[model samples]
Target chain A: MAIVAKSLKYTKHGEPQDVLELVEQKIESPQAKQVLVKILAAPINPADINTIQGKYPVKPKFPAVAGNEFVGEVICVGDEVKSVETGQHVVPLATGLGTWTTHAVYQEDQVMAVSKNVGLAEAATITVNPCTAYRMLKDFVQLKPGDTVIQNGANSAVGQAVHQLCRAWGINSIGIVRNRPEIEELKQMLQCLGATAILTEEEIRTSDIFKTGKLKRPKLAFNCVGGKSATEVSRHLDNSGVMVTYGGMSREPVTVATGPLIFKDIAFRGFWMTRWSKENYDTPERKQMFKDLCDLMEQGKFVAPVHEMVPLDKFKDAAAAALSFKGFTGKKFILDMSK
Target chain B: MAIVAKSLKYTKHGEPQDVLELVEQKIESPQAKQVLVKILAAPINPADINTIQGKYPVKPKFPAVAGNEFVGEVICVGDEVKSVETGQHVVPLATGLGTWTTHAVYQEDQVMAVSKNVGLAEAATITVNPCTAYRMLKDFVQLKPGDTVIQNGANSAVGQAVHQLCRAWGINSIGIVRNRPEIEELKQMLQCLGATAILTEEEIRTSDIFKTGKLKRPKLAFNCVGGKSATEVSRHLDNSGVMVTYGGMSREPVTVATGPLIFKDIAFRGFWMTRWSKENYDTPERKQMFKDLCDLMEQGKFVAPVHEMVPLDKFKDAAAAALSFKGFTGKKFILDMSK
Candidate 1:
């Protein structure tokens, strides 16, 4: 049987508001080794908007459904389906799967089963930001309990996740953010979320945190805002530390001094969740990472970033909020498809 | 007994030419586990000049004998010395030992014995540039025969060494040089030394070498000139490749785009010969590297960069030439201290 479901679709690449349209998408019954999924919630990530604007590196087919991440319920399974059963929660193993539709039929292997013990919004957002934060911390320099991590865009979803995970894992983190009018409020929020310290990017370069012995110097730095901000974060890195750049919200390139490179031997690297997902799709490490993250979430040691939940009919409002976001600020917008 | 020998000395840090002067100093006879060495030849490397200017990180003591690298002949050994015999050639095992002096007493372990079959200039320069090039090639990536390497500052001594070694190892190389009036000459020289292709920094960004299938894209990029030059060299790297920054001749910080770091998973790393020496001083890797480099030199597979060999008395002119060196151009200036 074929089922009609509401979906956010775009036939041309342009501004999300200009091109994205809500249309009825007819989804067919699951084929052998396929499962029909009912998307429970999906977040309007920046990549989603970038995909619509045609400014992103990934070029999906035209007349594409929008969204790259979602939490869905397996509603039906084909005769030969064995990996997932009806009523189980799942997350897409691969990225760029057109996740905005109310329902989708995926190959049994394309989805990874997830526990329903976590919050709907938290589950919806796990596959990208948290995974990125998790991998950056684990795969780069090994972080011991006493070691510190410094990162710009500390209020970003990934940064928030890093703080929570660091706390859960007994590691210390100093979050660097731009000085803003609500700086104190932001600082308090991050502190509550387990950040050991929060400072402006300027303060990080000449902070008393390490000088005053309040915190150890960082061995890993996360850079999302490039330019001087990236340099400042890297400047605070300990000898032989690594600076991993995952985003360039400032649209500036990363700049590094020649002195440290030659003398201290630091490294600059990058991470993209889409690429990581594809590369590690069948790896045991990926399964263990998700398992660990979910365990943290179930224990309430990890929670979704501060976000606003909207019913699917108000996706335009969510897209507007995403576009209106200024420099890693604002709450994430997640659509509740069941509404 | 004591030996009186002349050396280039600096009482304080300032302009290399202003602060440096040739002075005759007395060297005491070898103590227990020490050897009296007569300096043979040493090059006025950029690091040596920077140290004199106080711009470099490593600070030698005041009234310091200038020069960090040299090839010397062991003249006498104390009773307990076992590392080297009298008349054996040796190079400093550590940087900042002040190698410009004609005669000095060194601890037996402070120097590593070297074969004297290679040319004086080649051996003199080997402890730094060739070692740097060799390590950058072998340490970072596991490049094999037919693998390609891309590097900026192709005319640099290290760049020249990379070209020769790549050829000897059956690896192809593309050397990126700035567009100068002598561009064709520079290109021809690099090619003659076994560079598969020589492209200008601008040409590298859009070169047909990889597009036309003339050469494989480099898995490793050697960056000496930073800023836009570093970015251009990094642009042509293959997926998961690394750009190792050794020198910043342009005095501009290395600038890298976020796209490659994420999409291609490329890396930016730094290599400092001094740091590497300290870490690997007593390791078999260090011994093997020097042996490998020396073997190549003796086999006529590797030769020193074009250089002007100045006598010890003409130290001031060599200092001037080193200071006047413009953006990776000009020949190396080596001092034949035995003169």
Candidate 2:
């Protein structure tokens, strides 16, 4: 019998809504050591949009499937498959798996079985954003308990993940966000999630950390929104501290005054989860990072961000929502393949 | 007999020419563990000017002497002094001992004996600029023989030192300089010192490394000129490479596009020799670096930059020339105390 798989495919690089299309394919049974996975839920990440728009460094070949990560159930396995069995939930062992689909065929080692205790949305979205946060925090500065980290984009998925991780590690965090009408609500939300202090962009500019003596100089800075926000956060970093830039939401360059680099010995570095994962593929450290996140999720210490689930056929709507700049500012759009 | 010393002194921070004054002081005999040294030659470095203007991270106390480094001869030794005999040449073991005066009293350990084979000019300036170049090249990047490094301000003192060191290590260096009337002459001068390829600022912006491919992507970049020059140099760095900023001649911030940080994993850091020396004081590695540089100088491979020797009494002229924006662009002004 022939197995039919439905997927979102893009033949060329352009705007996601302009290039992405729904397509169907016929698949034969898995070959030796291969497993057939029926995708359950996949999130539409900003990186996924950038990939479709050809702005990201890693791109798919032409006439290729579109999504990078997902949670799926093992439907069938080849005769030689042994690590995972049917009905087990798993995620792509690495990135670039074209996860926005109804089903996929992969080699036995291409997926890792995850605990079913976490919800499908959390499991599906765990590989990228959370991993990025985990690596940047753990790899850049060695933070001791009571040490502080300051970051912008505090409400972002990775930013919230940093807050939760900091709380669990007994570290303090100062979160900065843009000025908005519901600033208090946003601050309260982040505080509930364990941010020690939250401030709007304006407050940080005229901050008197030396005068009012609110917080110590942050030992580390996480910059996802480059521009004035990134600069202000960097200005507060302790001597010889490092600011890791993983994303630039402001569409502006990372601007640093020459004084800090020469006098205080501050360093600026970039961290791309894709590059880090590929360079350190299948290391025990990476495995431990995932296991830690999974355990946190299972223990109800970390919850997935607010998200809207849409059926695969409604991809255009999902793509438009992911591309929208206004509503659902902090929510992810997940493709509900089961629908 | 009273040893009367005439020295440039600054009572407060201001323009070098406006605030610096010639003051006469009576020098005392060498105390226990102390040595009296008569200054021979001292280079007026940009850092010395910055220190006078109070713009540098290190500032002097009021009523301070005006120079940081110099070469001198041991005139007498105290009872406990053992490192060097009378007439032995030496340089300061640390910064902040004013060197522009005719004589100084230092603890025996405060000076290191050096070979008279190298001229006083090279010995006077060795402790700062050459040490900076060596530390930056060694500390930031793990450069191997045959690897390539790029830098701007190719005719400056440190730049020439970098070229000589790279030649010694069998590494290639692409030098970037401004467009000048004597551009070809400057290029030839640097080439004689061992630059692989020299280009003007415009040439670097339009370099055909992407098309004609004359040079490999540099594994390291030494940026003293910040702003666009630093960014352009960083653009050509190999993936995961670093750009070490020691100075910012343009007086602008180091601006970097976000693309390289996330896509190529390029890093930006600053190097202050004072900070490094203070932090790694009395380490064997630092001693070895100094020994290696001294050997290179004695071998006649590393020569000091072109300079105009001015008498110590002509302090105003030397300070004025050091502050001048034109004429003698790459040449240092040395105080000739013996004259």
Candidate 3:
């Protein structure tokens, strides 16, 4: 069967709202090793916006699909496909699977059969930020129950995931965010999401949580906002700690004093979700991660990020909203392709 | 026999020369596990100066001896001392054993009997800087014989050792130093010691050594001078490369861009010779490191750094010269305590 599917496509990199256009692509039957899927929801993540702006590492050729993550339903499978059958909800096992479309055909291995237990927004963001938080916490340092993980940009999508996961896993978390007029409300929101403690960037500079016996110094630190914020988060890490950088929202560099690096034996490293996904796809570890995350959702211990759902046709407004943190809304934009 | 010895002593933290005083102390005979040694030469290392100013991590109480490294001749050993015999030469096995005195009694195990094949300067300086260069090269990355290492502060004492050791190990080394009026001369000198390529900091900012096939982008980079210099050295590291910082000569924090750190998988870490020595003090690894370094010295593959030997009474002048770059002289000041 042939279907006319509308996809948000970009011929070249530019502003997401300026360069993206709705184009109709011919969707054919799944090849022998492929499966056809109906995309349900796709989020305009910062990485996706960066991809449209040509600022990300993974760039597809011209006239490429405009999104990298989404949740979809498997419509049908080809003769050689055994991974999923009809009516199964699925997502890409790795990144670079453009999801800003009504329908598409993908090779069987590139798609993961995710459980139907998660909500549309949670499942759509399963592969990027959540996986980043998961892998960084698991891979870099071993955190026992009650151990702490400190992070900056606690209001980011990844940070929200980190908070929930840390809570579900019985870990303590200290969050660093910028001081704002509505910070107390934001703090309350994140605390509900599982943040053990929250402090503004300025407060972290003078916070003696470690010294005053309020919280154990973090053995692991995650950084998204760079510059002075990154350094301040690093300063509170425990002896022989590890600080991992996953993003630079502040657009500044990570600066580290020689004292902590030398005297405390602190190690500085970077984690790229795209790279980690590409390397670990199809591995048992990746499978276990999805299973665990889905189990968390099934148990109602995990919830999706705060988001505003938009129809596919209103992608321009979604893109603009994602670009401007629009009045510090703390809300992600999920394009509801089902409409 | 009782001995009257002149020792450089400091009572409190201040400038090295301003606080140091030559004091006469009567030394007693060796205790059961002690060896009495007559000091030969002690060079004023930067760490020693920092210690004198109470800026280093390992600071002694007030009225402490003034130096950290020296070579000495064993004058006598007690009945239980099996490490060294009378007339044997030795150096401290680790830091914090002050070495400025003409004669002192040391616990037998605190010193290592070194071969007389090395010169006074080389033997006196065996425990710190050279060991720093040696351990950093061997520990971080496995560079096979033909692999390369790139480093800044190439005219530093550790850099000189790194050049010679790389030569002996058949590894290529690229040096980055400041561009000066005598740049060519410094380049020639380092090239003689075995730098595969030499570049000024400014040239490295735009150099294409890696791009032009002049040298392979190093898997290992050594950084002593931090800030932009550290950033430039880090920029040339190969995929998943590691940069180790041992000294912050510029007194600036190490700044790293999020791009290389995330995309290229570069890692930033610090190396402290004091920490390494303290951890590996009684281990076979320490013994093997010293043996390998001395073996290189014995084969004439390593030479003493450029130095000026001053009599013990001229200690203040040596301290002054050590404090000042004074026309950027590379010659280290060694106090000839034997006189």
* Candidate 1 segments whose C-alpha is farther than 4 A from its true place: B326-330
TM-score of each: 0.96, 0.97, 0.96
Q: For residues B1-339, could you state the per-residue lDDT of candidate 1 as single tens digits? A: 768988888899998778888888888788799999999988888888888888889898897998988889999999999879998999888788888888878889989888889778888888888999999999999999988999999889889999998998999988888899988988898889888888887787776788877678889999988988888888889999999999988889888888888778899999998888888989999989888988998998899888888888888887887778841563888888876
Per-residue CA lDDT of model 3 for A49-131, tens digit only, reads: 88889987778788798888889999978999997988999988757777899998999998888788788888987887788
- Name the better of 2 and 3 by DockQ: 2
* Model 2 spans with C-alpha error above 4 angstroms: A209-214, A326-328, B209-214, B326-328
Q: Candidate 2 on B37-91: residue-level lDDT in tens?
A: 9999988989898889898778898899989889999999999888888889999
Candidates, DockQ = 0.81, 0.84, 0.77
lDDT of 1 at A185: 95
Model 2 CAPRI quality: high
Please write out the lDDT profile of model 3 over residues B46-147, one tens digit for every residue.
888888878888879777898888999999999899979999999998677778989989999999998898778889877887899999999989889888
lDDT, candidates in the order shown: 0.87, 0.87, 0.87
lDDT of 3 at B275: 89
Residue A145, candidate 3: how far off, in angstroms? 2.6
User: Which should have the higher lDDT, number 2 or number 3?
Assistant: 3
